[model samples]
Target: MRWAACAAGVGLALVPMTGSAQAQEELEEVQEARRTLLMAMPGTPVSSIWGLVGQLGIGVEHAVGSYVALVGSVQVSGALQGTESLLPGGSGSSGQTWGVGVDPGVHFYLTGRAPEGLWVGPHLELATYHWTVQNEYLMGRPDVPLSEGDLVTVETRSRTVQYGGSVRVGYTAILAPGLTFQVGAGLTALSSRNTNFGTPRVEGGGAATDVEGQQLLGSGFGPNNIRNWSVSPRMTLGVGWAF
Candidate 1:
């Protein structure tokens, strides 16, 4: 009877140990699943190669639920312009442009949990840009003597605001424990409004239309006071660390 009782005591003691061990294993498994990622985008270099607008940015993704993740990014972009005047003896023109933007979206995983596998989502974007153009014109007759006011300088400035959205489909791969790579494709639609500031004057003291100024300086040199809508395709590639 004593031997049988000792056997029972051993079994009871092992039962609690086994249960504790199982709980610890489950906790470790949960810890191994990554829920957040930090990413760096190579979008700017690719876009520059394609002669398209490009952005430099940092992004983040966080799994909020089993099947959903939230993603966001901040970006900055810029372009430079130089053109020769359309008229003879016109010196030339130059422009400086810059912009900033933000993008935010939600991901719905189809084949796996949040931040993994294949996903589709909708994203929104907001951006603003500023442009400045400087030009010089030769107003005096080539055969006659020149005066101090014979050379005229003109400056034009404008601001533009854009808002848009896109629908994207992508796949994210966890290459290693904490390394991830992602690729995505999408269609984007955007609407923008531009406001031109300051009046442009030529040598004859006559004011020039914004369109004419833009053309004479350089076609598409600066933003105009028009509302425009456009649709385009977008591609993205990123490498990140997951935690």
Candidate 2:
């Protein structure tokens, strides 16, 4: 009876080993079968990264069939714009900014697959732009030539950051496989919430400008040009890649 009990225990242990070997063999067979299938096909490279994709991508890829693909892309930009006074360039009339910006947005397409060609879609863009204050300076001396007796020297500085959203309708121009160009502009709005006007050191005071009623001191992305509910015309251009 003792020997029979010992044999039963040994058989139970061997059953798990046998099952494990069978499972490993089945796994190997599935892999080699995939390789054999790849070899039988013409001109397609086999990749090790195919297994996870086969299991997951077929369910989520829009190109495969009806699926909701989560698509995302980045917008790289360095835009330039010139402006006129009513800003913060002291008494200067015009200025410019090397506007740097970044925009990111998403779109949902009503299609059963990753559709191609002139497709119009609605998009919302969140963008941030920075304008370096153009230090508008007084050429030589004051226009009135304050005589050297009543000269007032002033030092000032300014900068601006603008953030806003836009609703755009555009066609994605496919230049090639996986590459696209986006160009469109319908409706746009912007508001720069912060605007500052200051003179760091207004030396020799008493030099007063006899001008008033909304005089733009300089042009940049700062105050006066933009405040709450300030509306300006806008344009949009972008490029991206899809993988």
Candidate 3:
């Protein structure tokens, strides 16, 4: 339509002129521009990666769990000052480390209805299993007789059989019709304290002095222990089939 108007204007200009050929040429250019403009299509590729929008969803009388262990690491700045523990044998050290737990547990939703997209109920986990980091070292000097490197490695591991519960609130977004994407963040008030880090276990020493696990057991990390009052900031991402 706009090209038609341009052609009419060009024709009027030629009415007082002598060259019909020139007027036609200008009209052709306008037509070409219009055709190109009309042919343009949308260039955006439709995508729904990780569900761009936020949603709330609650699971009623459903099985709940933690996909990944709440791995955590802490630092000692006030009393004990160490960024991290040296890898057994002084290779490297870190303050703390956490491992995965192999305890499949389930819980029920307390929110009578939808619960505002949250499963506000209690969770009963079987046991909390953690990863282990341990190494050994000799004491005194390795080359010297009855004298090892005087090196002592550290062994860190933890596993606890405890039950705990927390109020969970998560949001679910309906990406398609029945398909839904959800993310949840909540706090856990655990009855049994779980350890994110344990005391360093130093072993091996020279003939004169042998560093046992007790020696390395600092104020915090200790041999076989349960942790508690830990604030775990959790995030959940998964697809759900809503019936």
Candidate 4:
């Protein structure tokens, strides 16, 4: 009877120890799941196809905690100038357009943890664009005599800046051990300003004033010259590796 009693005591003592060990294992698993540190993804906006422009972007997410992450993106765009039709009586028009932008945000995971599953966050956007064009046209100088060979070559340059904020909701899926795919959408409220810079130079004819040169180059080359505010929809698609 004493031997049986000692055996029961040993078994009973081990029951708690086994439970404690299992609890510890489960805790370790939770810690492991939350240990994700960083994820980098190259992505682009779905609407980038508009206006025949091409954009390249890289997105990064850094886990700050179990449910929160810091996210950012750097983007660049390029396109052939599309302002020939808008220029007044201008020919041989050629130009290039380009832009750079950055988006910074914080993501709060509603499901799973940082850098994975579904998440929502608020983000800020900042961007700048530049356009340069050279074209030949008659210099509209009222005081100057007109001639068939009096055409002037004018070069115009313009720039624009935009800033805004938006809230985004996205889903990130782990396709393989370290591969990730993400999609997101948001509505952004943006404020923009455009400016004509670097006085346009005139060659081969009568002198051209800066204002006249800008007008000849056309306003459609960039954003409106006035301060403007608008709301626009934004989207993102990306594939990357997550460590």
What's the residue-level lDDT of 88 in candidate 2?
39
lDDT of 3 by residue, 1-243 (tens): 999999999989977675677788885554333210001111111111111212232232222222211111111111111333344444333322222222122323333223113343333333332345555544444457433245656666544333454444555443323454544556554445445455555655544455343454554354454544444544444554533
Model 4: weakest 10-residue lDDT segment is: 41-50
Residue 186, candidate 1: alpha-carbon lDDT: 96
Tens digit of per-residue lDDT, candidate 2, span 1-243: 999999999999999999999999986554333210000101111111111111100001122222222222333233333344453333332222222334333333353123222323333333333333343333223555423223233333334454555554444443333454544455545545433445333333342431211122333224444445444444444454433
Total clashes in model 2, counting residue pairs 3 or more apart in sequence or in different chains: 4
Give the C-alpha miss distance for residue 210 in model 4, angstroms.
14
Could you tell me the TM-score of candidate 1?
Answer: 0.70
Give the Cα lDDT of each candidate.
0.75, 0.36, 0.38, 0.72
Q: Judge candidate 4 against the unseen true structure and give its global Cα lDDT, from 0 to 1.
A: 0.72
Counting only residues 3 or more apart in sequence or on different chains, how many pairs clash (N, Cα, C under 3 Å) in candidate 3? 30
lDDT of 1 by residue, 1-243 (tens): 999999999999999999999999986575447888789875432122114556788889999997899999877888786777565555677777778888899999997777888999999988887777777755444465434224555777777888999999999887656788988999989898888877764443234333344455565345557798888897878888988
TM-score of 4: 0.69
Instruction: Estimate candidate 3's alpha-carbon lDDT, on a 0 to 1 scale.
Output: 0.38
Best by lDDT: 1
Per-candidate RMSD, Å: 6.5, 17.4, 18.6, 6.7
Error of 1 at 3 (Å): 16
Local accuracy of candidate 4 as per-residue lDDT tens digits, 126-239 = 988787777766555567543333566777787778898998899977644567788889889989887878876666654444456556556434543758788878787777
Instruction: Mark the regions of model 3 whose C-alpha exceeds 4 Å error after superposition.
Output: 1-122, 125-127, 135-148, 154-156, 193-227, 230-235, 240-243
Stretches of candidate 2 off by over 4 Å are 1-100, 110-115, 118-153, 159-161, 175-179, 197-199, 203-226, 230-234, 240-242
